[model samples]
Target: MLTEEGKKRRDALDAEITERIAAFKVEQRKMLEELAEIGIHVEMVNRLPNLPTSDYVQALPILIKHLRREYSEGTLASLARSLAAKDASEYWDELVAMYLASAHRISTGPGNLAMALAAAVAAACPKNRLDDLTNLVKNQRLPHRVLLLTPFKKRRGRDPAVARLIEELRHDPALAKEIGRWKILPSQASLRSH
Candidate 1:
């Protein structure tokens, strides 16, 4: 435990991770600004694939920290949607963390956050991670429960992982009863509004 070489190696890795996180934040801000200029929308979400990947596996937790503390509701939702569209498997855990950390924000309401969480879960999470999605669906927020269920309600062939999630929920009597109470929650204001 007291080896100089090991300590040096650890220090170097930490420094590299810090540098990568900084770079990712810069690129994320630049992309957000670009989206800001164009107006955040489905079209903006569609443009995310054009941006270079940030190698999120290297810096996901840092990115999630930045997202949780600083990003606006619309921007968070847009980024989540973009991540969904990209469907980068490496991004799922941090996406879930971001959703859990910020889901209580009253600014966006649970609807948008739930939608974003659903999109991220549906697009990025693999079959093995279905348990995480199930846990997220059990979030205390009613909108989280309802909105997370939305993606699963789609055709089974569209996303089999999500379909599996639907089946899992169906077998859980508690979730089955909860899913039945789904209601129409109000949508958020336009994404263009800061």
Candidate 2:
């Protein structure tokens, strides 16, 4: 069960993993320090590493300021979610700008920055902003358009404007294929539930 070569390899692998973990911790500490300089305290950042545990009221302006700054995908997603949790409705335009600017870099996944931004917009966007949301869905390229349409899923049932937008998209030949493939958006039945 313990050939010398196998033991050596396992030990080497363990050492590499340990080194990587230590390096990652160092990077996190540096990032935290840099963020602290910009007014994002470590406690708020810690609460936002995953789901937001509390509202970062004092840190909201700083967080919004850095929302569009270059950062790792995970960090961006966390920031978006934290903003959404705080109901940053007043910064809706800024959030939409960030979402649109980052559309090209968005990856297809559940916990990605794009998804978080979509959720943030959904949480913060007002009735008057429906036109902007509709325009985004209509203008964005495939996949991104579909992803952008997702936020409406939560609203389609309750908001007549969102329902109309979904109806319009359903009839668009260009988007039919991509939208049909994923089927992640709200269905007609759900839309009728309200």
Roughly what TM-score does model 1 have, to 2 decimal places?
A: 0.45
List of clashing residue pairs for candidate 1: none
Clashing pairs for model 2 are: none
Deviation (Å) of 145 in candidate 1: 2.6
Over 123-143, each residue of candidate 2 has an lDDT whose tens digit, in order, gives: 667767777877877874523
Our tally of clashes for model 2 stands at 0
Which candidate wins on lDDT?
A: 2
Worst 10 residues of 2 by lDDT: 44-53
Best by TM-score: 2
Superposed model 2: Cα runs more than 4 Å off: 1-49, 52-54, 106-112, 142-147, 171-194
> How far out, in Å, is residue 164 in model 1?
9.7
